[model samples]
Target: MSTNKEMKTATASTLNQHVHPFDQLTGDEIIQTAAIVRQAKPEVDLVFNTITLKEPNKQVMLSYLGWDTSKPRITKVEREALVVILEKVTMKCYEAIVSLTHNTLKSWTYMPDVQPMLTMDDMFEVEELVLKDEKVIQECRELGITDMSCVFNDPWAIARHVSHPGREKRLMQALMYMRTCEEDNQYAHPLDFVPIIDLGLKKVIAIERIKPRDSKYSRPTIPLQQHNFLPEFVGEENYRKDVKPIIIQQPQGVSFTVKGNEIDWQKWNLRISMNYREGLVLHNISYQDGPEKRPLFYRISLSEMVVPYADTNTPHHRKHAFDVGEYGLGLCTNSLQLGCDCLGSIYYFDAVFNDHNGQPVEIPSAVCMHEEDYGILMKHTDYRNGRAHTIRSRRLVISQIVTVANYDYGLYYYFYQDGTFEYEVKATGELNTHVLAEDESAAGMGTIVAPQINAQYHQHFFTMRIDPMIDGQNNSVQQVDTYTLPYPTGHPKNPFGNGFTSDYTILKDTKEGQQNACYETQRFWKIVNTDRIHPYSKTPVGWKISSGHTAPFFAKDDSLVAERAGFAKKTLWVTPYDENQMFAGGFYCNQSGGDDTVEVWANREVQDIQQKDIVLWYTFGITHLPRVEDFPIMPVEYCGFTIKPCNFFIANPALDVPPTNKKINHSVLAHENSSKGEGPKSCCSTKL
Candidate 1:
């Protein structure tokens, strides 16, 4: 084991590469893992898949979290083990899970290691698989194309895409493109031949080509040589000089202090870590409640993001992607630059990702922590008495962004001074673009952007994993809604329709807890710690979950997406804690059709969710309609949900704030006795 000094030095040395200590798999470790795996299984027909650091089981991690300082035991950080997957060169592709501790192979699990057939095919590179097929070249020959270029397509929404009905399988489709090596616009050039290949057989089962209706061209073809679509700014055009926001800092500097990954504000105390799957994780998050550091959430993270398109056409049907699962969210994180991506005394966090070859690479400033003025958060005014009260709000924003192919998704978790936890999601960047004819109309698939370009329509759905501990751990879900009260015995005022009452329901079982939103009822869900009740309200301390911009999965119940991603069907899901069940779409969802996700786990009819360590999954999405402006680039659209305090605090927590007194100044007016008198001579003259 490495010593503390050695670990610190090692971490500092990797800072030049912008690598995080725990987030990345070191290059040295990867090289050593490769050597060990080869040595362990020397003479086997093994197709190496991935070798990565296997996160330790929760039991072991819990040991660290619950470590007793009074026990007087030596505390040393241990390195995580490695898990390598190797598949046999067979039809079913029997895979083996090889577990290695330090440098020694500890165990292997292979019940023939039969691949789970229900969901996506185990993780594999779509582009690599497409390029490896010799039939792709044959399809190119059939199209009379000599140039070698390929555009990959994902077969996520279409099950019969590779075969007939009732014969669904994991498949990937490839769109053969005509492009010369010297061509400047490779993406613009298109040869309309799509080959649907079975992932298991590695063979082209069918080829769907879009031929010209009037036989105008012998072979299906698109605009050959188009102008470059890549954006370029020459000279000083790329630089920002005259227009920039000036951020003023206080003479005393930032009020908050960050020691390593731990952030300390007025009340919030939490530790953070970044990973390839989940970009940012806040652990041991709690507020200073009186004497002890009261635990609110043990851990909170952005779990899975599924962006399923609405187009039912051939090419667009295979366009869906599991943004977080298929391509790791942290893996696609953008390296943010100062002054551009962030401002005002920002603290940037680094994320380390293991490339396809298992080599560690660092993305600098993958996550940023900064504070922004959120205007007035809390206020109380007495109109009759000329007395006023307010507390100006400053919100600490922790944000991370990931660009998967064309769309850019931003994940933000906000912490306010008044015990409010908010989250925001921003969608920007370009759409999954395509080419169209002059009068094609594009049907219901997409919209026309350029002369012959049909920028397809799509939807982006996101699910946030939240495990709340409101005051204490033993919690239950309380379903609350507003309902119309019975009209008073045919009273004349009954026609006003102004009577209503609040309804409270203790969600008994899983079925009752998994209810959809009702617009008429105006509903919200709350996770309440039944053991911890508020003194004033005489009710359990809880936080309300209110979501917006939510779009449900539009695919048919018998559709591929329905079978594969059942979690998308409902907006909210409540599951009892299962450490293995993390993602809503499931792990290894590359060519997955739907067996490993939360849908599968929820199907077991597991009961006793209430009073247990419960997990809440809020699925929110946008129904995107492509416009001409959405073609080259899209405007930033903001949509998100909030987790606000409900019966959790006795009084306004911001009531203790020192008055900035920006709204009105009664002191100077009273002192001067003049109607036109200004505010106080000193800002802090009045005792808040």
Candidate 2:
């Protein structure tokens, strides 16, 4: 891990080298880009919000990458930076494009009525500003919180509910909590009042108190209870003693080779990069089959996500959080620890982002890469000969964990030996809790996890941006569903009543491209290239996507959440590829009023997506109804989708995988049974 100063010195020496277009910008690039903007606008001070790479156009990269390897490769490519700047004096936002290759500012435009993504510095300043406010201090004193140090606040971005002046400003609500000590968990003691801070004034504009259920209302006192999850606080002696540690050792080191940002493992090859908003991104994914390197996905990343609380009451209604757009996930990423975050032959990739002062800050171990045992891949047995064959499965995992205030999301990408890939989001963290009202019941719209803490019902919706190059760039989506033949029992097509077949529907345009999951029909979508077809199957070479556990958006159509996060309304969406259309929730969503989103884009102008360079946006989520066991902290709850080869391969892709061997596995029997050795003398076989 390189410190900021060390990285600055290192980047200064390496800035002249030609890096890949997909590679992340070095620290020197960030510093130089910021300098260019400051030099051009010397009249006022600038607050740097974000400075990231402006990715090269897809068409240019496709042509550059398609060049023959035998000939000299094209080495000239444009390097530019996209910057979001806030004027310190005017309180206005501006977007700038800087040509890093030429050391010049290319363009600058003012963004009207839009707030950029919240920075980590902005969050820290909110806490300090709240602690020092006289009104906040007086309110805390009335609630028996005399010490300002014991008061903790979580800064949350407010969702616009009306066209009022207050809603138009850059504002954030501070959810208050009380801690008994320095190490105590503050969530168990949620306060009844919340402080609203205006970023421009840097002061608390108002303090909104929780509404009383009856006419005889009084200020409620803060709960002075402890619900700790740390081992020391929760009696370490009460922990289980029977649990044993199982160690995984790769004596011969790892099976993957990494050259710069690119990794090659088992037949898969891909490049990985981290963005300031989107944490981890994979590019140019391909699989090696013999001498041919087949392209799969051009780029894949978690585009946007929103968590909308179900409570309809005041204050709580504004709890909808756009974690990706409002606050960058990359900024919240944890410095992953070995054994705690990942295990066995791990490789960590550090991420870099600009601070409020336009200096480069590095988050060490922002991405973790490793291999995991995936049980069995394939197994078969011949009963007559008592012969059995088993092949163990192994998968490569690329993952990152981000902490957005109270909740943590573990984003992972799993690649298998069978040319299959999966994206999973593991949600586990402290539930955003509140003070339960004395007159309300826990069963209404929230659950009382602790004595007085009400953990409200919330749904986490995530959208994955998939730019697939299954066989080639031009592809179409085929929605496949299985249905029973609509014929009489005695008809020729349905001699048996149990007969069923798959129905394939090609989504031609954006109007009909919006789709939902149908449990009764076993629905799945396939990304296919019509230019090529399997010789035997007589079908387009393709990859199919099957959604795992999912749910529908529960908010009303006219609600604020629906207008802002419209991508969650459907499970699948297809649109013609556009470089600027990276975020599903628009570019700026800190205080957005629902005008720009995937739903608006798809409906704004219908475009033919079939047999064209297209993009797929998949939305999936989990509706979390809090339980008693999820009090102090929550266990990992999983939701994801899988992509597998449909007819892209000629046959079973893992047929050639070698069977497991005792010498290689080093297995042991728990019980020393005399018949263990004589039971089955299995021979490891490899298919020709």
Candidate 3:
């Protein structure tokens, strides 16, 4: 109701509806809307598909609600409506639309860009329908298979695999599995089953079955009988609460200044929120000096992600997924435990969701924020003078966990003491596997995770939609690269691999924007305020965008994965910032025919990007080669990119950061009570 509360609220612009948090209809609103609809047409058996809250326009929000909008002077006006989708089940037609306004529920003329994809019910029916098919049963029986179970394919994934991207057809996908009872039973593998169902047609388009691969070749399945258990201190494993007494306590205190969703630490300031699509989004990110607030980077968030499998077999050929577009990372978020997931003075944020019946559901502990000392941010010592200096860096870790069927992914946004914004994604979960017979080659496809189960190789590609407001709004982009010097003017040039000098090119329009790409010889690009150059260097104050461990797209150009997600083809792309262009994979990627996407927008004649609003799409990913260690679950494999300050600051921004402790104490506990036991600690000036 107030500005302070608005800042704490999870809100978004109409630019991209998916970015809006919990756009799904709230339970009370659904009940009220359903009543409104049924009162008008009693015969309406509405199968509600989508019920999202329409958000205000981005321009409107920025004008009315920008710049520390928490001041009470700002008026708090509610101008939002609910976008409801009501499908008629009896006649097999979907038409009616309704909206909830300040007055009451009323008929609405607006319609969705496309018919929404499979809901949870559709996903369930995928496996249920397969089980009901007599042909499938008879074939399985004929093959002497009985104890197997089934797993549904991610609906978003099925949309990508379908050869016809723009058929204007509604579909759902699933993979057959040879279910096994783990020591802690789980449905982890994918069978050769690829079922494509056409919702409008009300029948399966096709069911393709391919040869199964052997998991035992590399991934030796450890059956319950073969599982090795450590000798128990007590027979009851669940009652291990008494194994050892331990507790997390902070004797001193946390240094983070937290208020609602905002966090201010040392020199960093940021606001975090959880959404259904992009799990976490940070806004108003800045760095602080004494009295002046310096801009480091603004609005960094995960734009979209694509995971494409390598197998070209029948169904496997269509196994790619536009994760953020097809399946929502926010929708799949898991409830995390404080002690188990993270250990410290833990602070958690709850997430909101809506049940099919349109009831509001609160997922507790859906997001976690904490501080961790990363050993040492930087340290150096001089033996000659015995003078030493070390800055033990601390980081603010904001994270959310999402489980997409068989795999668990953790999206982490990290902020360091010295103006560093790092985005890291962790993949650790059961591999999509398949049951194999005795005679099969596990070559070229995957590593065996368990006996008779092969885990295929896949690539997970991601893009970060950076809305850089570098020193205040207007900024520009430039590419810098170093070239080997042919001749040295001051002295003899090293005839060897030798000397080098830097060269740069400004990205002015769409033509020049084409030259931007990541290469080994090039240094990171700078997002700078051209109008406001630094007094010392006469160069614009800027921040550098750096890439981490990333591999190029492996999907062939003609491949479906590439055809639909062309943004993955390049390492980086720059375009004029348009609130409407929030996603790289594209809006409505569920069944996209590759019509409109980031690249499509980039292809538009480029505008003046220098000293103008700019939106950047950067891609990074990993090539997952399965290993036996990836069995039940794999260790978290982290991959991401970082943003560091270039000429943005005059000197080391973190030079004033207080060190951790000057020394370690060897004295025991009792001595800590005496005057000599005050303990060793850093005596840096604690100034505001």
Candidate 4:
């Protein structure tokens, strides 16, 4: 290959007075002319310019030209006039050579960084010399034969070809060309050269294109679009207003007594009242009625007056009549006992009655009775002076009542060893059944219970009672009982309030051993935000679209079994054209106060448009699953997510921000012509 020093020396040697263009002058005459031009154009700086000339039979002629090179000015008027003459001569040279050789003369203009080579051997390998020269000559010949006289006139094209496979070379050539062109008096249309130079830039550096010898893998595919969509509940405002209110009422006829720190009940009874306009009946109530058979025929209903209680303030305590009416006679042996040797028994039964039309009605019921030995209740007894010992005594009290829709529906009563009676009842079927906690288990028992109960009578009713104790011991137990009725419509065993569907989709499988309690892995329903005071139309909607290329990925084990990873990142994508939006991991709500900006190409000009048809693309999610070897120092994976417009914005609100065009007068660019004295004769006046 030719070196810079050798090429520069050869070029200078070629500047002889014997050359055709300068043959009109002798050596002494050339020196005198040069001195005269130098003296007249003292401000001008001189620089050497190279040009390549081709002859017949693969011959090349390298020539040099001298011109002014002052700050911001390259040539004197004399040099400018000479350049015009030289351009015409060069055109003529092409025309004249057309007849001598079948090949046309293609002008290969390049930047200052392009060294002039006299032969193919100077720039290419010996084996490639003939092929490269032949290809160039063949192309020139074809152009000449076709009358295409302006073939290969672009300086950028020549520079790109010379810098092929070398990005650094291309950059150097581009920079030098821009600098030289600006300094030359031949600055006719310099701005038009930008695109030509950009076209020659290599897409990838040579170092990046190298492949590992043992690798045999293809690149991964990347999706062009991804976005996230968060759905909200619709009609939320109306649902909150329609739910019924529930009030907690206190228990009645309930009393407690303590004597010498021990309980001693002398009597026990229970009472219940039903206020349904029509008589009621309950079914499917069972218990150890007599320890012989599970008979289900015990039933009753309130017909008239409220059951009265004993008049005495102290009353018989446990011996009161209201106790009988409060605590129904149904009980079963499975019921728990409080004190040692208490031996409590529980029984279950159902109330049956008839409506105004005599139709059958039934409701499930349960009751428990205790029969403790007197020895347990006499725990604190003491003898003083042998005069009929007496120490302590206590009493047990219990009461319960349940009402539903203004109808008395449940009742409970308890008797204490200390002769106290307690009666209580409460309203039923008024409870909020949702609002689960995050760590709730799938078993449906937690700090709160919201069983989904429907109004349809035939639909099975389910209620989960968390005892937290069972089998006479504190063995935690969660019992879920389901009951089915025959009617099509009836009162709900449990009410539904704050109507809202719990719904969501799980993008990944639950981690092993995750309870997934109140933490539902899937979406049950869509939620929409309707609380905005204004209607949907009044709210401005906008979407921003963006796109980006992701970083390359590689396998964990460095195994060739898997394909070479390309841009595998999952990107967030939003489409204003379509309602669907997606994010790499999953769609989240489009609420504000987040990383709001979308990813876009670094060059903003690429997305300029007049309408709102922008689609934003974001990459996120796991690009590759980790392998065992990827443990300790796990390689970082590339992932990205984005949020973009979802038909949520009105048309260009920023249109009136500013207009971008401005005009300036070029008269300020004019300068006085100082090279008039040093004329075109300088071109012929050569010092050789």
Candidate 5:
């Protein structure tokens, strides 16, 4: 392997050559090699003769984007030996013309500058001239023309003699005189001009004059139509209704735990939480239906206590406590349109607190939530006409706020259908006592009722409900849904019953929804910090930052004592997209699609679980509402839910060893008789 120092040295040397004496030497060598380069390039040759100059029958003029045709222009003429003049002038002119043509042709051509600018007609005319090379000489002999003289005059000079440059531009004059004839309806004949030699003897290339065809003339085309597709009835509604104000209650405490290979539970409890306040007002006005048929609107405001905890034990030397709060909005619509049209905002404020010594101090708190529009659209056949179609578009808006310190705050907004917003807010003061205890009593203190976990925690589950008004009526309700503390068993699959499976099972099931239980329960977490201790001990003597290691449990393991917890064996379900599964999908499939699918599977599981198993908890359509207090700044709302373990595992059985690498290789040969084409062999085909 190459070392870092060696790589740096090589890079430095390569760069040094370009900036020092080596660069000058390289330039000299390039100049010395010009002849060799030219010899290596391809060449073409053509023969031609001088002809009389006649007025063209037709002409065309071209102009640049900003060129003015009213300005006078001067044309210079140079007199030099024929041989030297032709060599120098033709080389420069051909280079410039070829460069311009090549740049334009790059949009389509593949052979670079070799392609000619003339069209098919020009090519056909040139071919005819080549075939009649001797015939043109015979015609001149018949006309009694003997002496030959070459003429070199700018077309612009001729234009000046006939009309001012303001009337006839140089380009227009050249096109008219050289390309067409004034009286005769025939193209100009170049054979009428004689060739002249000044310094050397050399046969001249044939000169041919061409004109733009009159029938081919056309004016540029332009588009002249406009189209708009926005709905005509938007922003025409007046929504106003009265709703009651909400009073928030603080929760007693919060807790955190890591269960069996699943998510780490960060639970909060707001004891007397109100879903929605009363006496709020809303107004509704519709543009299409006038003032009478306007839609009704309502608003409710509520506050809840916030608490935050670490999954692992809190540090003994910690000086401050932290509380985190989140915001959510619930929608219940009676509109036959499925409550599709809705708008709401949430505002957050920090709580004043006293330190452990009862001294009042202004604490800073922040709240943030995903701010986006959320709605649902339904399409059905129109009863009036089975063939006619009717559609409705509903809109929901959410705004989030986050407050970090006493004065530090942030806010964000988003718009989407069925999307949730979350932000983090800080607490004003620290708690005097450590809220979390390393004992079982602390496990179920603030449990919120979650029907799905009732079977496991039974009567231990707690519940709270907040009622918020809808359209100025007591029509909506919000529920603070929480689950009981989970129990941990070191099973890799079905960690939280969220449908995610392990990498091992993912490799086995190529199709969707066929994952094994072992892979389903695994979860990943970042280990912020760690303390090493003697096996079976609770005291830590060493510390290290564990950045990327996985934490896969959401509950405490009862079987392991506090001491054994240090040595506890934890298993995480690895998703198939993990690095270890790279080769499992074969080379081609792996290259096209990678580990991004792991997040997709997790999102799918979240949606599926919300729809099927957890119906008792009412889902607040995703929103981040803006409040008056959130104007100058907003706070972050940390919003998330919890799930407790229930009938999620089976007892372990005797170990069943898997085939070894060598055995897997040999199995391919043994199964060759049953295989077709180049199919891969199964490692399990080997005999035990």
Candidate 6:
């Protein structure tokens, strides 16, 4: 396939002035990149999987950003594209680095015995092929699926279930589903059979069922009962009636300034970008303290995540999904609506990715940004004069939502006025269900949410990659845990037996940095800059990482899910900053045999990691047991981690904020009558 599409070339001066070091590759840039790669390899037909910006070297980019004072400010940084291509004939993968700045190929290396992530076209093509195959039609007909128009399937990455045949081929297993109508929810009526397809040959290689057609364990017919959440099916009158109209408007416009991808809101400043794998990413995060800009993190993102189901059945045991690596979050992102996804004055950003044929695909409004009122920041009251001082709290939120098969994940990044950063994942969608046969027990494996539909137990583990710039580049991690005194009642240390102390341990090496969350001890890790001393506290300036709900790897040690998802086995991992070591689950994890992951990288050596440029890999998750109410649609489940200042700031950073004023707030008290009560009359007393 010849990619001879014409692209308008920009002048060198215009290109250098517009493109930032961290911006996503533009559409024109992507077209130019594919053309350059085709010119270098004219003899071979290449299919493009990923064509993204190859970020400049960290130190050099830092110098350009003026972070490195020792080196002169570098002006012109080369724009490079990291392209992954597949040979259509041989089915071999290759990683190429093309210089978009010079319009030349830099290097190309063939990847041995590996498969790239499944693209949107790959998923759609397999579904089409399976629906047309005679074998699949006959199998479905036997299961009472007479009309194939209502048949549906979800293409999932085959992690490592070697018990089945065809281990050498690039494959995907389609979990079959059937809907009563076109708009019906398919997950609520899952079929019993699964079709395995060889992506290279474009054919259904094998078919696996829950049990033999004559066996008692398998259900012979698809569940015809309708379970749907759409408005047309649920009826409009069934919706909530008490939800009043809440209008959020900014007459003076947004409080933030957007110049390209960088945003400056209140005292916080950061740049946001999106790619195919990690979705939304924050870069060059910092805060403006009066005239000084205090850098907190160089980059932060949801590096990788896995959803492993707990059903031990043959085909069901291979249900683990590497959402980030296998099917990129960016590719699955939804175009958010205005008043639904985000309210108030909002700013949106678009994402650019490549299709199978090396063409640019843009998902417009892929990111949503806005400010929200969060109750109160600080409050004080004096009894003497009945005077009060209160300051309203507000936060800046950058978020995106992605739908991966049965789950819709809403990823949000929040920045508060008190110099705190939060990352939250909201999981809500249709739960993956299967129709149960008579006398079949889902006791240990899953939960029967409906009459006969079973939703399996599962866990969603997320690995967040945090590269801190605390006060400077040189940083260290200290594991801090609170413990009660172990002395006797008569001893001098614990005379009251209520005494508690904190144990601080500086993680000196990679081995020592692999720590776990201890809830009994109230454990947390602090990323500190030893070189920067807080004069008042006489300690290192630092930020603390506080995680929410966490769980241990539930899969057995020798299981395929456990072997491939090694990053979820530990809660925290610290390693010296290396640009190439970004993902916790390695570069390619679609059909990975569980090698070259974060677990391997952290244990490669006992190198000293103290007082150096370091990155923190935090893995946190939730163990989900499907509920009866989670059938048609599941409510949002929240899990996240927070980063707060721990002596990094001399005092409360938000102390300078103006007090809450009735004139600006314009809030009214509700009353039984038509008339509304005016807000508090006294406003001057609440001034800060």
The estimated TM-scores of all candidates read: 0.80, 0.95, 0.82, 0.14, 0.16, 0.95
Can you write out model 4's per-residue Cα lDDT over 1-688, one digit (the tens) per residue?
1111100111111344232221112223223333433343354342111111111110010111111122243221111001000111111111111111122212222222222111111111222222223333353343232222212111111112222423223221110001122222111111111111221222112211111112242211111121111122123453557566322111221132212111223332222222122112121111121232221111122211111111111111111111111111121001222221122221222222222121223333312222322222222222453222221233332222333211232333333333222222321222111111223221222112111110100000100101100001111101111233323343363243323332222111111101111212221111111122123556222212121222222223222101111112112222221122112111110111111122112121232211222222222122222232222122332222111222222332222222111111011122444433332322112234
Residue 305 C-alpha lDDT in model 5: 18
Stretches of candidate 2 off by over 4 Å are: 1-18, 67-73, 161-168, 214-217, 671-688
The lDDT-based order of candidates, best leading, equals: 6, 2, 3, 1, 4, 5
Candidate models: Cα lDDT each: 0.63, 0.85, 0.64, 0.20, 0.19, 0.86
Give the per-residue lDDT digits (tens) of candidate 2, residues 1-688: 1111111111222445557888888787889999999999887579999999999988767766772344556667899999999887456888999999999999999888888999899999999999999989999988877899999999999776343443337788899988998789989988888888888789998898886444344655567788889978978789999888766666666788876678899889999888889989999998887788889899999999999999887888889999999999888999888788888778777778899888998877788888888988988778897566777889999999999999999999999878889999999989999886555455578898877678999999999999999878889999999988899798888887778899999999998899999998999999999899899889899999987777989999988889889999999999999888999999998878778888988999889999999999999889999998988999999999999999888778888766666555546565565437633334445345
In model 1, what is the error at residue 145, expressed in angstroms?
A: 8.2
- Which regions in candidate 5 have their CA more than 4 angstroms from the true location? 1-302, 305-307, 311-376, 379-398, 403-467, 471-688
Model 3, 4-80: lDDT tens digits are 11112222221223232223334455566556655665655555554444444544444443443444433343334
Largest lDDT belongs to which candidate? 6
Kindly list the per-residue Cα lDDT of model 6 for residues 605-676, writing each as its tens digit. Answer: 887889999999999999999898888899999999999999988799999877766566656666534244
TM-score top scorer: 6
Q: Worst ten-residue run, lDDT, model 4?
A: 456-465
Q: Model 4, residue 108: what's the lDDT?
A: 23
The candidate, 1 or 2, that scores higher on lDDT is 2
Q: What is the clash tally of candidate 6? A: 0
Candidate 6: pairs in clash: none
Model 1, total clashes = 10
Who is ahead in TM-score, 1 or 2?
Answer: 2
Candidate 2 C-alpha error for residue 220, in Å = 3.0
Q: lDDT score, residue 131, model 3?
A: 65
Q: Looking at model 4, how many pairs of residues clash?
A: 85
